[model samples]
Target: MTPRIHGGGDHLGVARWDFSSNANGCGPCPLVLRAVQEADPSHYPDPSYAALRSALAGLHGVEPARVLLAASASECIQRLTAWRWRAGDRRFWTPTYAYGDYAHAAAAWGLVRVKEPGLAQLAWLCDPGSPLGQGESPDAVRTLLNQTPRTVVLDRAYTPLRLKGDSALSAEQTDRVWQLWSPNKALGLTGVRAAYALAPLGAQPDVQTLESLAASWPIGAHGEAMLRAWTQPEVQGWVAASRATLTQWTQALSDMLVGRGWAWAPSEAAHGCAKPPHALDATALRARGIKLRDAASFGLPGWWRLSAQRPEALTALDTALNGLALEVAR
Candidate 1:
């Protein structure tokens, strides 16, 4: 099995100035935080998650029956792949560069990777995509919808945290595909493992299969609370307001990097990739209590993906880079 490659706090512990994760730099929204903190762990969550599904469904203006819960986005990816495979999907498609889990899950099921979208039985799309933060083209999505893929899942993990531009797919187009949402990132509560998907219109049969395949009580009380809080108006408002601050921080971070001569791939989200003029020494940066996500795992070697961080974190990054430069000069 290929080891999963991900960013954020790792075995050594959290980075003091972590730029590895794409969680909302300004949050752990207070309201959501309170909900999670206050969650009672004395008992199990409702096995069926009825109220939670209704709330999530209402948030997206979909039927509650269209909701499918998962322990996390990655879990959903694995389960969905397994579901499709059991149903006889032998080929899958993913963007040229995308979340590792998509390919990982497919490989686990012995599904062949197909380059062309139409050749796939299962496909994954991430709008405001990771590593690049580029939005998918609506026309392309429309075209794909008209194709033969039995299951097309749009990972909306970054959509809530998008800093600029709108989602390319409109509501109607969105209704034609599965919309997988992981709010933990948007709420700055990545530690919380909770995610749900809105099944395509009239996908009840598919939903039933997915549900049957799910482990009972997939979400515990804390995850349940965090997700429930996500449907609240104030929590949404908090997330919306944080974007302004993140936008400012993003500009400052971009200016700092550009000034240092790094090649930037501008993103519409708080996080994006850039190639440092020289190959970075991950250990050296970690020694300085700072961390950056190397893009090699995402197939963009020599480039690093960084999220918009606070002024303090940016200054720390600058100092760390200077130290590296001095070492190179020596």
Candidate 2:
């Protein structure tokens, strides 16, 4: 069951941390804008977005051909879902999670979504377990891919997480791992709507079809422009700064928790891959005005996750959480 969202989020917006999302609190990256400035919808994306592919390929140490661009990681998944499954086919995933949209897409096309593995024909992996932002080691991930008989749809939305010691899948190394990178979370490209996928080195049967699915509707000129912005040097510096800022907030939240007599799980990446210390009762926190995210929705009931925010916002959150302790003690 969906844990109730305390205070019921208002439609347009609320304090965004409620979603366990990432943000720099620094708006509109100038570098991101410059990259987008080069976009020319008048001419289709340069036969094959060569420069864009080259930049990412060089970074990931993969040949340029292995990369595929899409509007977003979610869109990439939807395309993959279309290629592999059929009506009544079981789409397996862990529970209390994200990808509710993926489930809905499957249903619209007559695919069955199975939370547990009961005759599942296909499985999509959400690493670090959804809302909790946890990650499995590379070896652990390798094991799951090898063990699951169903075709694996790798959704590493939050994997390769954090600035220091991040772990992204190598597109060139693994065939089963079709990894996704969401600049929205990592790069704060929320409205930019640009994501890319990495697949096996073999000739792709799904490529044309996936491309068709992606291109069926026009790729907006503005979105294309925004994507180009992601490849700029100025943007890269901004990205680095944002990452550092995110790291700071993550540490602040952790320290505040410990000060409050709470503990957190071991984290690989600084901010994104952590679990609430075993005693952090997210459900209890909700009873106060804390507006905690339900990690239960992401397969872990006890943990809670928060996104990077302005220092002022963090201060407010600290006040709310401290008050929760007082209220709970009473």
**Lowest summed-lDDT stretch of 10 residues in model 2?**
1-10
Candidate 2 local lDDT, residue 180 = 68
lDDT of 1 by residue, 3-77 (tens): 588989999999999999999999878899999999999998889899999999888888899999999999999
What would you estimate as the lDDT of candidate 1? 0.91
- TM-score per prediction, in order, is 0.98, 0.72
Tell me the tens digit of each residue's lDDT in model 2 across 210-329. Answer: 666667433456565665555556666776676666667677766776676665654444343244444565555444334455555455566665554667766777776677667767
Q: Runs in model 2 with CA error above 4 Å?
A: 1-12, 16-19, 24-28, 33-65, 86-121, 126-129, 137-140, 147-150, 163-176, 215-218, 270-292, 322-330
Error of 1 at 263 (Å): 0.7
Q: List the residue pairs that clash in candidate 2.
A: 35-228, 35-229, 36-225, 36-229, 96-297, 128-134, 128-135, 160-167, 263-277, 264-277
Q: Best-fitting candidate, measured by TM-score?
A: 1
Which segments of candidate 1 are over 4 A away from where they belong? 147-149
TM-score quality measure for candidate 1: 0.98
136 in model 2: Cα distance from truth in Å? 1.9
> Positional deviation of 130 in candidate 2, in angstroms?
3.1
